[model samples]
Target: MDFRPLAHFTAQDTWLNDPNGLIVRDGRWHLFFQNNPHGPDWGNMSWGHATSPDLLTWTRHPVAIAHEGPEAIFSGSAVEQDGRVAAVYTSAYADGRQAQSLAWSEDGFTFVKDPANPVLDRGSTGFRDPKVFRYGDSWRMVSVEADERTLLVHASTDLRSWTEVGRFRDEPGTGIWECPDLFPLRLDGEELWVLVLSVQDADGSRVVHRVGSFDGSVFTGGPPRLLDAGQDFYAPATWTGAPAGRRVLLGWMAQPTYAGATPTSPWRGAMTAPRDLSLARVDGSPVVVQKFSPEVTAAFSREVADLPPAALVRCGFDGDASWEFRAGPDVLRLAVEDGSLVVDRRASGLVDFHPQFARVDRLPLPAGTTGFSVLLDRCSVEVLAGPLAVTQLVFPREPFDELRTGGSASARVFAR
Candidate 1:
């Protein structure tokens, strides 16, 4: 198994990163990303574009905005306006400045920088990742405020002038909320849902996710929902019913702790498989499960085998490894030793690790086989463990890992 990055919507490329500006225009889908033209380093941030007609196959286009023009173009949303497609992105120019910049395109590829660049730059701290949407006869934009208390949601009747509407209250636990996005959804048949995410200090152990609902002016709900039960999922963006209709989402996965400071490598980070999203009730309250990409099944079709009756098996990584095991209805656990591995289902739902190179990753499901596969590289890891996939660069303490197998049924591991 060659452990490389995964692309959302489609999977032709192995090293695709963040899913940026996922918008639907003229009955087609446009996806822009935070990309590094040179390779997988974060320093060369640029927007990469892709288009799809059925959300399955994708055609890669040119670098959306070559180098971050005046300010580094971070990420944001796009909407169809006045018969053209418009994009609003967070930019920190080359001269050492940051603000929100907007652009429009007659076609998805060639974007003309709006002459009215920096349309709404209030000399606040710094405005980034502007999520623009159309509601009623007016348009609304929500951005992350310096203070966690206020996730600035602004209103604009026309694309030029803007006014501050209000801020979503910052509650008990919020570190530094980045990338604020909000949209409405219909649940079951009666209720509606609104969701938002604030990327926190990557150096910290986990990321933050919050989902709520709107009643015209503001939004209210319980504490923010944890989008990813795992430690790696972060900086998630949601696109609600493209062209206007179930929301779908894409998330960036990273070892926040490994960013910036690390010497960097052959690859940087990647976006989780695109998920069909919807606000629903789990445990009597509301939670969101990004649906698996339909492409997962296609990959399975071409798979050598399914590890039929996907069992639990102790797996090992010699120098580095690759392969996936279909999960069973039971929970599972995996442990890597000096040169061996162990697989069992009793200790599912929980994850414990050793400080050294030895590592443990437990992808849990309330009722699914603990069976899974592993894709390992000398210094990287891509696990198709439970859900879509989790890819990362791991500086393991040791040079080799031994896999041990346990449990009633055997788990599966495939090697390319």
Candidate 2:
């Protein structure tokens, strides 16, 4: 079976993980990620580079930041400050020590390491993944103490010197937390901060977010709720420098449970399409809602009856509904029941290669949710409805070709 994704962001031939150094500079979107330059499995952790005029089509460039001697570059964020692009990342040493470091570029493509590197060091192996942004009269940073499941918040006046101001710890951790993002959004003229984190354990990995208030030094928030219920969404980060009022996010679309066992060679991971995030009221409480960015929606705007290898299948219903996409003997099923959107891929062909590959994923939808959209690629499926998202990676022996609806369900298939 062919596994090349046409509409998703993937490395041409390498392993990729958390997206790093995401920013828009000089009218182009620059995407950097945790990449293994040598092979298809994760190692030689350097930053891979790519640029996009729009978020849908990407052009690959040379490795942006490579490992130096005993230090490997890890995940981080980028900003265009004071007429240059600056990146603040984690420099992980060979002896299991990690510290925050700095790199800068005059031209967004080539980078120069700061001679005075590792501007911030905690002397802890678990400290890494710094995400920096502009704040009042200076800059602010949020990095993770991974094993401790705590977020370390720091402030800097010139991107080099940092002072620890506040910290937020997730209680009784089930796993280590990594790749956090803190940003603000306005809803109905009220401003609220959103914190997104990726948590991983032996069971699997999932993304969660909290809505709260950040007062430059401390973030006081409410309970943590899932950002995505799907088994494959993790390590999401929003790009800086978007048009005013737009917060665009992208995530690595693979889970830790079966990432090593995926059948794809030369490339082992892909990114979810860019999601446009906003806030809306649900049950009288404010929650984050995700919709396909305009670029992605325009790519899959053609309507069809037979499912293509890459397409978007949209379904609408009044009450209970069910839909199926069948190709030969394999069938992938979807249904709405018990206030949940269910995606069943247990019978979607190639499942035996990894025991965890075949499963049912469910996302709870809002009460008035009458429709949901599924983005299909050669090897994955992402379901979105209102503020609910369920992303799963699937491997079928053959591509699905037909869409069938039942129980008051109606469907419209769109292909690029």
Candidate 3:
């Protein structure tokens, strides 16, 4: 099957993983990612750059930060400072030591490593993935202590010097925490802090998040919850300087079980389509609501009659809704049943890559959600329903382009 997606961003002839330094500057979106320059498999990690005026069409740039000595450039965040773009990332050393590093770009395409590299180091073996943001006149960063399962916070006046301020302890989980991100979401005239982190173990990886309050130093939260119910969403990053003062996010759409086993040669991984994030009241409690960005929706102005293998479709319904896709013997079903969003891929085709790829994943929808969007590609499906979104990777032995719907709903399909 042809696995190329029409709307999602994928690196050309290389491997792409966790999103890094996602920021909007000068009306363009700069997306830096954890890339393996060597081959389709994961190795020789560096920061690969791409710029898009609209999220639909991406222009790939050269490797911004090449692999240095024994250290590989890991995931981090980006900010616009003093009319220039600065990237703070984790440098993973070959000896198992990790430290925070800095790089700056004037054009947002080419980056230069700082002379005083390794800006912050805790001398801990598990410290990495620095997420930097502005707080008052100083800059704040959050890095994960993977071995200890804690988030270490630091403050810096200058990007070169940093002081440890506070730490966030993680709740019980499978493995180490990676790619820690802390941001504020406004809900009911109150701003709440949302912490996102990825958990990895021998089995696979998943993203978990917490909604709470964060003072200048410490983050106080009760417990964490799963960010996405689907199995393939991981290592998500939110952009700082987005248009119209919006918080946008993109997640890596692959899992550890069969990430390297996909049939897409010369390119290993792709990103989930960009989603606009906001806080909403779900059953009287605040939850993160993810919807397709306006930029993505605008790209699908031309409507088509049927759902192509690669298409963008939006569905609206009130009480109950069900959508089905079939190709030969393979079938995939999506439904809102009993106030829950269910994605049944048991018969979606070609599940031999992993044992858990052929199961049904369900997530509770908001109390009054009546509409949603579905972005379907050849090998994956992303569903944005009310306050929740799911990204799942699938493989069909044959391509499926037939779509059917039930209940009081209308489907508008678009192709690029």
Candidate 4:
């Protein structure tokens, strides 16, 4: 088997996690991530670079910011300012100290570290992952105090000098928080702020989002909710320089328990397809809805199925329904029962790689959920229904050759 994905993005031949510095500059999409350039195991943290004219196709470049001495580059965000692209990331020291630092690239590929590094240091080892963006007349950054489950807000005029302005604490989960992103979206012409971050504890890794209002100094958000209602999908970061009124996102599509033990060679992780995010009102509450980018939607169709080892399967149903992808004796089942979408992968072939890899996931569908779309790759499945999304990595002994649907459902299979 060939396990290379047809749509999702993966490192050419290494390990990568936590998408870093996602931005669009000069009409091209630039994706940077925490990469281990030397091997498939996660270590030697650095920023790996990739560029795309469109999000669906990518070209891998050299490592953007490699580890030097005791400091390894960690997760952060990128922004375009004054005709140059600036990356604000965490400089993690060998002694467990982490602080925010800066690097600049005139061409958006190669970067030079700031001479006066640790641009925003509180002398706290847990403070990191700076996400910077323009607000009003100045730039604002939202980094996390990981161990405390708090988001630290800072203000900067030059993107170099920073000062703490406020902090927000999220206490819903047992895990520490990391990779915090704050942005605004419109719901029915009313602007609402969205905050997204990752929490990791003994159970595993997960991402959560909250919709709220943000003043220049403080952010008051609603209750935290799972960004993706699945066991996988974590450390999601949104693009910075997208066209006006567009918010696109990408996430690390694997969980911590089995991340290092994935059966794939040459590369250890993959990214979910870029998702176009917007706000929809569900029961009078603003909720985030995710859909594939236009480029991805156009590439998948109702026909053209006999090409690669991957496919996009879409379906529509009401009430109770079921769908299955069968490869000989192995079966991956998805069903809607009692208004919840259940994805069962316990017997999805090749499950012995990791005990945690064989499990079932369920997401409560929004009322009146009429349909869903699933992107099926050789080792993963991403399901989007109503306002909920579930991403999981699956290892099938053989590529699925048959798709079965039950109930009053119409199905469309797309592959290129």
Candidate 5:
């Protein structure tokens, strides 16, 4: 049940939170993260970097950026500008106000602050976490402006002088849309741009992205589309393609409450699988779907079942177990009872966890109940149940990794 820690990714680490700059340079994939050196809590947020030629084999680099600048250097993006790498970020100052700052890196690892510190700080009290991009002849910035009620878009040609271009309200009538991301997407053969945010409303919090158009000066678009069904996903941002291509994405896995909550490991909070995104045929709508990165599939030590639709198969994976099964509808399910186990799979892709965790006192099933492709990586289980994904942990806290059912138990794969 033990796992070899991912090279750039950690399991024995404390709080590896936000996915910072995710981009491809020189035919290489670069991943930067906001990591807390402290255990499971959001503290000193720094940019930790890693690179990969192929996603499977990751190479960890230095602690790219630390908490030396105004308070903790929050999340931001890096881009190649003027023949050098320049980063734009929301700098958290000690007074609790945010200022947008620029940094330049010639080597892509070491970043030096721009001579014009706080280049565009317009006293947007909570102005932090700046996302900058190049659009045609101008550079654009989408940032959280007011402390709680506003979002702002600015236009600048030199990443220095900034001019307010658009304003959006996220009041209760709307929602507290945290990270405002404005980008372009192709849907059903239509050329369109989308504005997205990490939103919190009366119901709860979710990742929301919307369609909007820029008519020379202003943005006009519909409301956001609630993207993630998982209760745990948040702070998603898009990236420019690698070598040169389409739009990509990166998101932090840590929720506000889950920040620093899990136990310390070689890695703490991890991203959901790195996915290749595109406007595709999703149940008839032009929705975005994640085609699993090859690296995600490469992690499977034992691939038990690759069942087609409505196929069910069970096997006794006695003792300690770790596996990833490509399930179908009814979907795959695995249960544990009094340290024993059960697995249920349905035909249309819904998963039940009650029987799977019966051994753990048969915890009541939460609402929005559905089937899932249970990814059991040691004590970590990621239930990918369509849009609603849930991650759970089970630490044995005993002298064995084996489930305590008369000393052993069994698990199998089933397709309803």
Candidate 6:
């Protein structure tokens, strides 16, 4: 079965994992990712570079950071510092030591690693995935200690020297926390910081977020809640340098269970299209809101009346709605019942590969969620309701070519 995505961002001939260094600079959007250039199985990890005028069509560049003597370049964040773009990443040594390192790019395309690499080491076993941002006059960073399920926060005045401020630990869970990101969102005329964390283990990986307050040093928040209720979402990163003050996000759209088991050749993972994030009140509580980026929506000019197998479809409804997609022996159903959004993909196809791939996922929607969008690729479907987004991967026996909707819903399908 062919699994190439039609509208999503993917490396043409390599494996991609976490989205690294998503930033907009110099009138272009820069996307760096965890990539293995030699093959599709995820080794020789390096930072793959790409840029786009808009977020839709991407132009791939050469590998930004190659493997050093005993270390592979891991995930990190990028920022513009003093007329150049700087990338702060983790160097995972062959002997199992991980440390934060730095690289610089005069232009967005070419990058040079700092000679004084591995700038910071906490002397811990699971420290990696550093996300750096500007806070006041200093730069603040958050990296995960996977073994301890904690996030270590650090502050640096020049991005070279650092000091540990505090650590954010979560309740005991089955997985190890990996990517940790902290950013503020304005809601109800108040600013609230959102802590984004990704937990991964043998089972798979899932993203959870906490909404709270963060001073210059410490972050205190409420309990963590599910960010995306799907089996294929992980390692999400947000960028604030977009047009307006939009907090745009992108996530890896593959699960760890079948990371290297997909039928696709040369490439193994792809990223979810960019989503504009906000905070909305649902039942008197603020929830994370995700919608398609305006630039992404504007990229699709030709709109048809019905879904055409693989298309970017915008959907809206007044009351209740239901939709079904089918291709040969595969069928997936989506509906709204009693103010709850349901996705039943039990018979969606290719469930025999993993035990946890076939299941029904549900999300409670607000009272008046009148519109949403579904981005249907060749083998994946990403549905974005108001404050909930569901991403699932399915392998139909044949390509799904039919779509049906009920109630007052209408589908506007767009293809590139």
The candidate that achieves the highest lDDT relative to the unseen native structure = 2
What is candidate 2's local distance difference test score? Answer: 0.89
- Stretch of 10 with least lDDT, candidate 6: 301-310
Candidate 3 lDDT (Cα, 0 to 1): 0.85
Best first by lDDT, ranked: 2, 4, 3, 6, 5, 1
Worst lDDT window (10 residues) for model 2?
A: 355-364
Name the lDDT value of residue 79 in candidate 1. 77
Q: Assess every candidate by TM-score.
A: 0.72, 0.98, 0.94, 0.97, 0.72, 0.94
Clash number for each model: 34, 0, 0, 0, 36, 0
Writing each residue's lDDT as its tens digit, candidate 1 over 217-303 gives 576767765566444466777763454365677677654554433222455555555556565565566555454444433333333
lDDT of 6 by residue, 114-181 (tens): 88887998766688999999888889999988888988899998888999998887667666898888
What tens digits encode model 4's per-residue C-alpha lDDT throughout 360-391?
Answer: 87778899888998888887889887589999
lDDT of 5 at 385: 32
> Which stretches in model 4 have alpha-carbon errors above 4 Å?
302-308
Better of 4 and 6 by TM-score: 4
Q: Report the lDDT tens digits of candidate 2 across residue range 245-286.
A: 589999999987778778889788999989999988777777
Between candidates 2 and 4, the one scoring higher on lDDT is 2
What local distance difference test score does each model get? 0.55, 0.89, 0.85, 0.88, 0.56, 0.85
Please give the lDDT score at residue 389 for candidate 2.
Answer: 85
For candidate 1, the 10 contiguous residues with the lowest summed lDDT are 348-357
Local error of candidate 5 at residue 111 (angstroms): 1.1
Candidate 5 local lDDT, 230-320, one digit each (tens): 4456787776555345666656654454444443354567655454455543344444544334455445434344432211222333343
Candidate 4 local Cα displacement, residue 17, angstroms:
0.8
Better of 3 and 4 by TM-score: 4
Clashing pairs in 4: none
Q: State, as a TM-score between 0 and 1, how close model 4 is to the true structure.
A: 0.97
